[model samples]
Target: MSANADRDDRDLEADPASSTSGPVGVPVDAVCVGCGRTRVTRTSLEAMEIDPRVDLSDLDAADCTSFKHVCRSCWAITWRNPIAILTGLLESERGE
Candidate 1:
């Protein structure tokens, strides 16, 4: 197996959160760090690539850790034209 794959396997084995049952001892209402979306359980947030090491015990509904939550339309637009979005943001910033 490739190095990265091997490493991932090791990490999976070592991390309790990566287990099939999901993160043990973690809160159920943790917010996703990527999309700022609240996941009622670790399994729900697992789909967002959240690091298992991040603390979720004191997570609040209003906290946005990483601006991770984007509506489907916004995600689609971003995937379709990242450059266009950046250009628009730059233009707006420059008042042009």
Candidate 2:
């Protein structure tokens, strides 16, 4: 292929409509209450848009200092052993 042909094939401007490719300016924090672990990541705006159907009562936390984020790994572990996770949480709270 000629140089001109290659230049023509290349894109001059990025598609702003593309949500997948761009600077990850949006921040997302996921916290696991049981182990007290936090996972912070930057993603696209579209990825974090709130869904009306989802009840975000936690968003209105009175103190505004609460643990509502949970990493995917922790969620998976909870699904596999919910009783163990819940028990551990309770034990930690009781200092037992």
Candidate 3:
């Protein structure tokens, strides 16, 4: 009945995946696809010893490389060979 409650209802309906607790509904801290390292929100990317120079645009909306979650190390490696990775993703989408 209240405005806040109405908003909550709308949000729940809009995103069925939302949750009040845990990693299921929230943005995860940075994850390294290369080493399978999961960083929580408290740790800075630099503190994780991740490369700051790596461009993260190749990572898709889900914060993944080629739609697959990768760590900073793996991202660094993949970034070095962008053409191959992009071509592979495109090819995969084409079922080639």
The C-alpha lDDT values of all candidates are: 0.37, 0.37, 0.37
Candidate 3 residue spans exceeding 4 A from truth: 15-68, 75-96
Arranged by lDDT with the best first, the candidates are 1, 2, 3
In angstroms, give how far residue 25 of model 2 lies from its true place: 3.6
Q: Which ten residues in a row are the worst by lDDT in model 1?
A: 77-86
Residues 1-96 of candidate 2 have per-residue lDDT tens digits of 599776765544334534234353334353445555555533333334433233333322122223233356566332111111122332354494
Candidate 3 residue lDDT tens string, 1-96: 699999998887866553312222113244444565554322222322334343433433333322233335555532111112132433454483
- Which pairs clash inside model 2? 31-69
Native-to-model Cα distance after best TM-score fit, residue 13 in candidate 3, in Å: 2.3
Best by TM-score: 2
Q: Higher-lDDT candidate among 1 and 2?
A: 1
